[model samples]
Target: MKYTVLSLFPEIIDAYFASSIMAKAVSRGIVEYRPVNIRDFALDKHKTCDDAPYGGGAGMLMLPEPLGRALESAGARQRFVESAGAGSAGRSSGRVIYLSPGGRPFTQDVAVELSREAELILLCGRYEGIDQRIIDTYVDDEISVGDYVLSSGEVAALALIDATYRLVDRVITAESLEEESFSGGLLEYPQYTRPEIYDTLRVPELLLSGHHENIRRWRLRKRVEKTLALRPDLIRRGEEIGLFDGETRKLIQELGGEG
Candidate 1:
């Protein structure tokens, strides 16, 4: 899959892409990414991308011309102009998403949905926000990482990328992805490593047992227990989705969770 990010601050994107699993994935060609600077598409000598709102507002609003051109360069549309010898897809496009506080709540499901796309163009808005015309013209969806606001959308874009990329084939082991929090509507069971004893507390005995069956059951029970303890809402939703089987349901009941 290819990910194209349109941001005024490409440096932020660069730092993240330069390290860890993202770096390895890019090197192996398992995933491709390109960061396009919104400023690069600015039209004038001042290289300005934002201006005061027409009706007036608290902060400057990003200009439609620069942002529209940036999205065009990022593949929001198929049309092209010859100045830079580029097309609407300066990179490519499967979906165009704008990161904003007023967008759909982003979740693991959304990450899974995006990971299936052949390409994704992420727009990171700044200042007051992008011109509405840009969103109406090119955006397929708008997504938010959380209820709170952040200084820049690049941070949110990186978060969306992190959640989606790890699910891509060859990015990580399939088992590693499946056994994680939110994988099956439940938080993952706690994990422990060497140094069995820490702060006078020992790792769970079941995890140490060589018996695989008992350990598996223990993990499942603990998964339900933890979800119920920390997020009963998830337990309720999981039950509605039939995410738990008969044994798991029984386990939830044992933990005082409604089936």
Candidate 2:
């Protein structure tokens, strides 16, 4: 997948893209990144990308022109190409997403959906936020990583990129996705390694007993237990989605869990 990120702090995105799984993906041509520096498109000598808000806000808002310029130069060419393949003649469904608080909450489902995209453009807002006019004119979507606000959108953009990239074909083992948290609307069962017993906390006996069916049962029960204790809503949602089966329902009942 191709990802174009527009940000004042392009270096942060650069450092992350050059390290870890991102670097490996880049090396193998599974992923691509283009970091566009918003300040580079600034109109002033000081490269001022922010300004006082029209309504007299406490903090400066990111100016729309420089950001719009960066997005246009970095993404428009790709949009044109994608538009041709889509045969739409004018529009590119290739997303130009702005990271901000006033946006739809990003989730694992969204990540999986984004992993299929041939290209994405992420707009990272700094200072207070970007001008609403720019968002209206250029952004395809706005996404919030979480409820809490951050100093800059760069970190959130990188996180969204990494999460989405990992879901791409061959980027990670398919089995890993099946076993991880949120795959079935439940937290993953506990994992342990090395020492069989630590400080009297023994590894679950079924796991070590070599009985595959019993281990599966134990794990399922524990998953329900953990979810009930920490996030009962997940269990509720899981049931609604048919993620639970008769065996799972029986196990939850055995553990005195509502679901």
TM-score of each: 0.93, 0.90
lDDT of 1: 0.88
Candidate 2 residue spans exceeding 4 A from truth: 77-89
Question: lDDT tens string, model 1, 1-259?
Answer: 8989999999999999899999999999988988899998899988899899888769988899988888777767733444675555433446989999999999999999999999989999997888887777678899999999988999999999999999999999998977699878889998999889999999998788889999988888888889999999988998998887889889888889898
Expressed as tens digits, the lDDT of each residue in 1-259 for candidate 2 is 9998888989999999999888998999999888899999999999999989997859999998897688778754222224344542343445889899888999988998888999898999888898888876677789999999999899899889989999988777898888677776767899999699899899877788998888877777777788888988877777777777788777667777675
The C-alpha lDDT values of all candidates are 0.88, 0.83
Give model 2's TM-score versus the native structure.
0.90
C-alpha RMSD between model 1 and the true structure: 4.3
